[model samples]
Target: MRYVFFNHQGRAVLGVRTADGVKVLGEETLESLLERGVDLVTYGANAQGPSVEIGEQDYLPLMRKPGKIICVGLNYADHTKESPYAQPDYPTLFPRFNSSLTAHNKPLVRPKVSDTLDYEGEMAVILKSGGRHIPKDQALEHVAGYALFNEGSVRDYQFKSPQWTVGKNFDDTGAFGPDLVTADELPAGGKGLLLETRVNGKIVQSANTQDMLFDVATVISTLSEAVTLQAGDVIVSGTPAGVGFGMNPKVYLKPGDVVEVSIEGIGKLVNPVIDEA
Candidate 1:
């Protein structure tokens, strides 16, 4: 089942996509529901509540307060080639705070500090439970759902130091939802799906999930060996080549630009770019 968080009557509520419309689960957030072990599929099927036409409500990040937002860089071979760093045997991981997350249709702020705001379209995996040292073979079992992400970056800040945290975690830079498709709704480890990014309706990046150098399972398993993965923690499976930074002449987002990231089976996450106030 597809799940989302949206604003209903001025309050944030969890919702499940229904044949009629979006069924309001409750005022509880997605993270709360998962933490309580609520059976989303069952609740969505049997619970009776108000429903709203999808386009009429305000969208929220799929999980408003994910415990952690772990991102993998250079997970796609082509992206690694385009980047300045040499390809490594291990996954290149980083963290994004919740402060950076904005919902679908929201504005991605291009900070005044730099005009190098760029887009990296990606697929993100949300964990259903917590574990440590999880075996790579069994990693798929830990995924709760999948969603799309626009890893909007402030390029100038990113390369100022070896650490990418500053550029990647700028408030309102990352766009992360529309809805979450349960693991069962997609292929194992979300493999074989087409992922693409478009700017102002023009395709800029295109690739398949199969092209990822470190697939979903490997990322989860590898991270688990060091940090304990928790329920509602999000893993942003890195983007493919053709990012604005990788393009010839180097295209970057400007005010009034619309960026859309779409993945097969999952849905599109569209956001507009605006100058930071």
Candidate 2:
């Protein structure tokens, strides 16, 4: 089942999408509910709250301030070739602060310091439970669900240094959410799914989840060996090729552009571009 969690009346309103409409589940982030041992996949079958129409209001960060936001870079071989860096033997991971996150349908701000805002349409998984030294075979058990993300980057700032934190962490750049599709609804490890990205109704990046050099199971297992993975941590699987920065003219986002990232079995995450005021 698919579920949309947005903020309403200072409440973390979570609702499951049904044939009738969106039926409210509770006023808590999905991560929090999973931490409390609530079974989201099956609980909504009978249990539910009032139905409400949620709009783009309070900024919903999907996991809602999830403890860890781990991002993988250059996971796709084709994307790695387009990138300045070489393909890595292991996953290249990065971190994102909560301030950088924006909700679905929200505006992706182009900061005044630089106008090289680039989009990396990606798929991310939220952890239900986490632990250290997790084996690859059992990693999928920890995934709560999957969501779409526009990992907006300020290219000029990003290439200024080897470390990508500054360019990647600008406030209100990362677009997340729309809905969380439970793991059971999709193929194992989110494989065999087509991930396509579009800008202003034009297709840009397109690839399948199976093309990742480091898949979900491997990323989780590898990360666990070094750091303790906690419940609510999100692992954003990297984007495919066709980022504007890789283009000959190096296209960048400006005001009035709409960016969309859609994955099969999941839903579309769209955001309009606007200059930082």
Candidate 3:
């Protein structure tokens, strides 16, 4: 089942996608429901609340506040080739704070400090349960669902130092939802799906999940070895080639540009670019 968090009457409400409209689950957010071990399959079976027209409500990030947002860099072979750094055997990971997250249809803030705001379209895996030292083979069992992410970057700040935290954690730069497509709805580990990014109606990045250097299973297993993977922890599976930084004439986002990140089965996450006030 697809799940979403939306603003209704100035309050955040959790809802499940239905054939007619979005079925209201409760006022509790997605993270809260997951924490409570709410059985999504049966939670709203006898719904008595009002259904909201999908496009009429304002969207919120799938999880308003995730415990952690772990991002993998250079996990795609094609992207690694376009990058300046040499491909490494291990996944290059980074942390993105919840402050950076924006919802689908929200505006991505392009900070005034630089005009090099770039986009990294990737698939995000949301964990259903918490665990540590998880085995690679069983990692898929922990995934709750999959969603799309636009790992928007402030290129200038990113390269300011070896650490990418500064650029990656800018408020409202990252766009992360529409709905979370349950893991069962897609292929195992979200593999074999087509992931693409389009900027203002033109395709910029295109690749298959199978092309990822380190698949979802490996990432989960590896990450779990060091940190306890918790429910609501998001793992952004990295982007493919064709980012603005990798282009001949850098094509950074400008005010009024619309960026759409689409993953097969999950759906498209669209956001507009706006100058920071």
Q: What local lDDT score does residue 29 receive in model 3, on the 0 to 100 scale?
A: 76
- Alpha-carbon lDDT, every model: 0.90, 0.89, 0.90
Number of backbone clashes in candidate 2:
0
Estimate, for each residue in 1-277, the C-alpha lDDT of model 3 and write its tens digit. Answer: 8888888777778888887898887788767777777655566565667777765339998888888899999999889888889999999999999999999999999998889999999999998886999999999988888999999999999999999999998999999998898887899999999999999999999999999999999999999989999888899999999999999978899999999999989999999999999
The model with the greater lDDT, 1 or 2, is: 1
Q: Write one digit per residue (lDDT tens) for candidate 1, span 1-277.
A: 9988888887888888888888887888778777777666666677678878655238887877899999999999999988999998999999999999998999999998999999999999988886999998999988888999999999989999999999999999999888888888899999999999999999999999999999999999999999999888999999999988887888899999999999999989999999999
Query: Please, what are the lDDT tens digits per residue for candidate 2 over residues 50-112?
Result: 766777565476766888899999999999999988889989999988889999989999999
Candidate 1, residue 90: how far the Cα is off, in Å: 0.2
**TM-scores vs. true structure, each candidate:** 0.97, 0.96, 0.97
Candidate 1 to truth, TM: 0.97
Off by over 4 Å in 1: none
Instruction: Extract clashing residue pairs from model 1.
Output: none
